[model samples]
Target: MTRVLVIEDDPIIGEMLTLYLTEEQFIVQRVESAREGKFALGTFNPDILLLDLMLPDASGTELCSQFRQLTAIPIIVISMKTAVADRIQAISAGADDFLVKPFSMQELKVRMKAVLRRVTTPKPVAVQHTQADSASMPESQLGLSLDLERRTIVLDGDHIETTFSEYEIMKLFFQHPGRVFSREELINAVRGIDSFINDRAIDVHVTNLRRKLEKNPKEPQFIKTVWGVGYKFIK
Candidate 1:
């Protein structure tokens, strides 16, 4: 069974999530505060985390950062804040997705499944060298190699962690280096064209990717902005 840890302060919302998730055959453990949530992380060892932004003890973003350092498990933040900034903040803090309050249970489930699918499914790594030949390639020759099975990026002999969206975006960039991709094209490729994700969200994902891959994010070397157009990978 898939284990889920929900950190929600509101009793009603917590109960509703537990009930619905349980009906879906998920093993859920809901907590009402950040402290409890932290404890559950060790005990429950959940496959995914459903976090509420307004926790009683600490903000969800803080916990999100902390949890991300401890585990690579996917996190989906649930909040009443609908501002684009809020969504960006959560994603920057390591959330895989964000859902506003008063959201339909069906929509939440779909988002959960989508996020989980990205994390669990192992896709082909898009790079010039195959995994077997990667070890034989010179360090300078190896640009960015994806390990979809582990959901990680091997860059310059370093293993870097990436969120689901970041991994998807990087995979697309590796497949078509030197091709400028507009924000709309990137959003469509990563999150589906029908997704309501803000265009700025793509910027946030790219920024995060740069932080992980580039030596200096201020002046990125691998992924460059085309100003007015979008971005392209030069690797």
Candidate 2:
């Protein structure tokens, strides 16, 4: 049976999650503190964990970081902490995703599905290499007429340039228009530093990439939010 570990301290919330998960047909284990949660993880061997950021024994982010060394099992941090710093911290600690507190069970389930999808789905076959070069590749895919091979992004018919990291970020999205890539996944494709690159760096690179490529960076249409996960291409 598929197991889901719920690490929530609030009795009412814990029971609610248990009821919801049970109805979803998952074998559920509920724990009230970080220590119990860690113990459950070992004996239960859960496929997914719904972790609360505030725990009696340890913060969920700290716990999850340690847990990642033990297993790559998907973890979704569900918390009241919604600050950008909170989001970045949780992800850096090896969480697959984050869900702010006061979310519906429906949203919870969707995030659970996304985390499962990301961790379980096989890596996309690396974009096929081509001697044809990035310039030779189709420009329509870029949302601009950029010479991809030469690493010069064309803006208003002028060659605007991107850093190597920025170019890799663009190419990854350009290769699959409309496909979203979690920042962790993006780093993996770019510098083989999926586990090491800071998430903020990805955000910065994307910010600059959009500025160079999109006509209206404020209301960007080419790259869009996947909400609670990552970014994707729209054009």
Candidate 3:
């Protein structure tokens, strides 16, 4: 039984989410503002959080950053902020995913599972490559080489810090260069089965990866977007 803390100001939306999540067998605790959410955190010990950007007491962005400092719990922002910038900002502030308003409950469930996967799944231990593993080595593209065995990425011979999610996305791209993967496909591949694809979350991850791997993130040379479809890797 997973415990979820929902920090949403709207009583209607909060109740709606609580009812739906309850139907799914999740233990939920709903709060009307960031202050209440923070106060409840110590007692509820929730596994995940459904946060709203607008609150009576504090901004979700500030709460998100504060929450990250206190705990590593997964957080999914449920907000009306649909702009790409808003989504990116939320992610930057520490939310694992962002769902725009008018979203379906089904999508919310899928996204929650995806974020949980990131938290609950054990990370693979980095190791030295064997001859057999060499055959499966991640491909190098545009001076970027991902040493999956070493669990590190080398950009022009320099190692860069990267998150597991970013590594998963990049690995898929390296495995299938020039193959355009829709956001849904990417989420499924990276986050596993029953994962939901939030386009904005995908964009934020891609943007972060591009900054680390590409010479110019604004005009990437390795990862290219297939407008209206998704993204692909090109040498």
Candidate 4:
């Protein structure tokens, strides 16, 4: 059975999570304080961690950073802080995903499963070395073209510098247009399962990619947002 460690302060929410996760056949260990959570980490080997951002003893972001330094265990932050900055900070601190208050049990379960799947699934192989390896490659899309051999992108005949992260992300996007990948999925797909890169970095890479590839970054055409979800490439 998969083990889950939940470090949340609210009794009502803690009890609610325990009940729901138990129903889903997960072996859950709940702690109400950050201190106890730290202790549990030393003693219990959990498959995943369900952490709250606010605790009586310590800041959840600090705790998350500390925990990440110790292990790569998947962490799904459950917090009441709904601000965009809060979400970005949580990811920067090393959380695998974030869920705000009043979230449904079904959504929590889905997120938990997604994090675990990313943790367990084998890392995908890198993109092909050149376009020759895969025919029918998109030569130009909305003025953005890729030179696989040169590992560079050209926009309207001018080469646009791209970092390895940006290159990989755009490559993935170009390979499968119209597929809506969640942030977690994009992190896993681009950086591999074992990479320690903060999930927030994906946003930075996408922003840079847009500035380079899109005619107008403010009003992008090739890469579009899926609202609350991640971005997708559109042909």
Candidate 5:
């Protein structure tokens, strides 16, 4: 069974999550605060974490940074912080995904699975492509005006910081522009995450990524959606 650690302070919410994850056959470990959350890391060896942004003592952002130092376990922020900046900040602070509160229990489970897919997927060493091939290869770095080698996003020729996974996903899309890719295909190619379109996990990541790279997210010309299909990176 997969192990999950839920770092939530609210007893009621924590219990609800525990019950649901339990039914899903995940070994659930519930912690009330950042302190206990740290302790459970050693004992439970959680594959994924459902972290609350607000704690009784310390901030979830702080905890996320600290937890990252100890392990690379996927951290999904379950918070009431619904602002765009807040969500971006949480992701910057090391959250794999930010889930707003008042979300359904069913939604939480699907998100958890998506996070787990990315977290548990095996990382195989990749061969470096040839320089000549690289010359022909158009990377997302160029589409986003980012420097793939330097790992920097350039907006109007200015650098914009992005998470590792975000960069990887962008690179994949940039390499194959105009190709329609299912969420599962995108996840596997980029971060090895599972497709959970019903829960809109891919949409959230794409939105976050667009806001970082696009000058006007409302009118995104690069990333387009296929109603019954999936997402694709277009010109």
Candidate 6:
């Protein structure tokens, strides 16, 4: 069974999520505070997390960042804050997706499935080579080496961790160096054609990728912004 950890302060909301998700055959564990949520992370070890932005102890964004540092588990922020800035903040803080409050249970389930699908799907390793050979392959102009099987990037001979979205974006950029991809195209490539992910979310993922891959994110080397068009990877 797919395990889900829901960190929501409102008793009603927590109960509703537990009831609905349980009916869908998910192993649901709901906690009422950030403290409890942190405790459950070790004990419950959920496959995915549904987090509320407003918590009794700590803000959800803080917990999001903390949890991200601790685990690669996908997080979906469920909040009453509907501002675009709030959504962007959550995504930047390592949330995979954000849903506004008063949302339909059906929509929440769809978003959950989408987030889970993106993280769970495996990318095929294109080359048949030994690990050493793969590691020694020609590096990108930015000196980054990708390992498809591990879904990680080696930068300056050090392994760097990447979120599922960031890894997908990096893989696409490397595959089509110098090709400008519109936000919609990039979104479709990483999150699927049916994805409801907004353009800004893609920007956030790219920004996160730049932080890890670029020596200076203010003036990127390989991942260049094409202004009105979108972005491109220059080899």
Q: What would the TM-scores of all predictions be?
A: 0.81, 0.54, 0.56, 0.56, 0.56, 0.78
lDDT score, residue 21, model 2? 83
Predicted candidate 4 versus true structure: per-residue lDDT over 1-235, tens digit per residue:
8889999999999999999999999999999888888788768878788998789888857777776555556777888887877777766666667788988999788877765653442111223234453344455532666667555665544556554446667778878889998888888875456443555678877887788678699999988988899999986
Q: For candidate 6, write residues 9-103 as lDDT tens digits.
A: 89998999999999999999999888898899889988888999789888847777887766667788899987887777777777777888898
Task: Return the lDDT, model 6, position 78.
Answer: 90
lDDT of 1 at 109: 84
Candidate 3: RMSD over Cα atoms?
7.9
Which regions of candidate 5 deviate over 4 angstroms?
121-235
- Tens-place lDDT digits, model 5, residues 71-128: 6566778888778777666665666767788888877777667666544321212234
Estimate the TM-score for candidate 4: 0.56
Candidate 4 clash total? 0
- 2 versus 3: better TM-score goes to: 3
- TM-score computed on alpha carbons, candidate 6: 0.78
Query: Model 2: which residue pairs collide?
Result: 134-149, 135-149
Q: Per-residue lDDT tens digits of candidate 3, residues 1-235?
A: 9899999989899999999999999999999977788888888988888889898888847777776555556678888877877776776665767788989999999888876755542122333445555555555422677766545666644555555557678878888988989988986776565433466778878898889778788899988988999999984
For each candidate, the alpha-carbon lDDT, in order, equals 0.80, 0.69, 0.75, 0.73, 0.69, 0.79
Residue pairs clashing, model 5:
none
Candidate 1 local lDDT, 81-190, one digit each (tens): 88888887777777777888888898888877776766674222333435667688687746767776777788854567666678888888889999999999987776
Q: After superposition, how far is residue 128 of candidate 6 from its true place, in Å?
A: 25
Deviation of model 4 at 107, angstroms:
0.5
Which candidate leads in lDDT?
1
In Å, residue 213's CA in model 2 sits off its true spot by 32
